[model samples]
Target: MSIQLGSNQEPPKQERSAETRRQLLDAAADELLDGGFARFTTHGVARRAGISRGAQQHHFPHKHRLVTAAVHHLAERSLQQLEGITSDGSLNSTRRVLDALFEQYAGPLFAAMLDLSLAARADEQLRDAVQREEHTVNRMIDEWAHRRLTGCDDAPADFDELFAMAISTVRGVAVLRLLGHSQESVQRQWKYTRDQLLRLLVENRS
Candidate 1:
């Protein structure tokens, strides 16, 4: 139940009882990645992580707790991966970030998560967490788009236009990829989409 923010030097440590909790989260992620949330079980996670069932309960106590925490952890990991991709200031850094994000869940894992997301509509808490994660990710993307678009004085007259276009373009690419499109096709279409969006953002820029 104890969490510490990162300090100036070393990484913050979790509470004494958090080791098992971390393991449960890791196991849940593997289960979700392999079989989606429908197949996720506390017992299965415990076995996968090499801990007792009671130990898993001692950490999660309920399935919902584990579900929410695992989703949050995945979202954070995705963000960190993006941060790494964007670390370099190369011309294709943004494209690299987008590609990296898509690469992680390129196959059945993405499909499973999307199915689980649809199924979670009946669960208000789970739905809210998913919405919040999506909001955070989209907000970051929007901010990056704004910065890139606003680099020059003669860029788009309205920031909202650029943000909306960026959001719509990415959403379209994701939907296409999830609907059984090949990765090669996704990459081709994504390149076109990215180029068009960048053109809109920097079209009139000095």
Candidate 2:
């Protein structure tokens, strides 16, 4: 008599492989966040992932490949989360949009990206890999913003420049948080920057 597999049955090999890869990517991001790029290692990631070193190497043989892949993986995950948060129609106003963007920039994903970017400055191969990953993520973000932002359809002539400035300002605040700044100070600075950007947007709309 043949037995039927229940919902609790183990996943297929392919599904398990994908799950392992996902875990490795998550662990890789955590390693970068906890130890930074300078101390990141494949063995460390494997251990953090609770997988064998050979398994980790099977997916990513080089450190640069692993970290770059992790960066892209985390970015994709973060964007999906952002979509869920913003799709509820609660982000109706420009201020709410700015708040969401700032929260995302200050999150662990951006923190990991910043660490990789700084390390890339001295490593040519890693720099190339990081640049490629960053370009892909930036394109994804641009598409997301176009679809979700409120004023894009009637944006100013220099909309891209203004948007770039907004992103830069948020990133600067995020870096300050990473450097152990006080919460009150960070929030104050972010409020000032947010107000300035809102004023610019309003002025441009006129």
What TM-scores do the predictions have?
0.73, 0.81
What is candidate 1's lDDT per residue for 1-206, written digit by digit as tens? 89775655543355535776777787887877777788888788889988998778878888877766776666556555555444232336545544554454454434555766786899987787766755654566555544543444454467567657666667668778788888788889878877776565544343
Query: What C-alpha lDDT does candidate 2 achieve relative to the native structure?
Result: 0.79
Separately for all candidates shown, the number of backbone clashes (residues 3 or more apart, or on different chains) is: 0, 0
Clashes of 2: 0
Q: What does candidate 2 score on TM?
A: 0.81
Residue pairs with backbone overlap in model 2:
none
Predicted candidate 2 versus true structure: per-residue lDDT over 149-206, tens digit per residue: 5434556677668777777777788678877789899999999988887776544565
| lDDT against the true structure, each candidate | 0.65, 0.79
Residue 203 in model 1: lDDT: 42
Residue 14 lDDT (model 1): 57
> In model 2, which range of ten residues has the least summed lDDT?
84-93
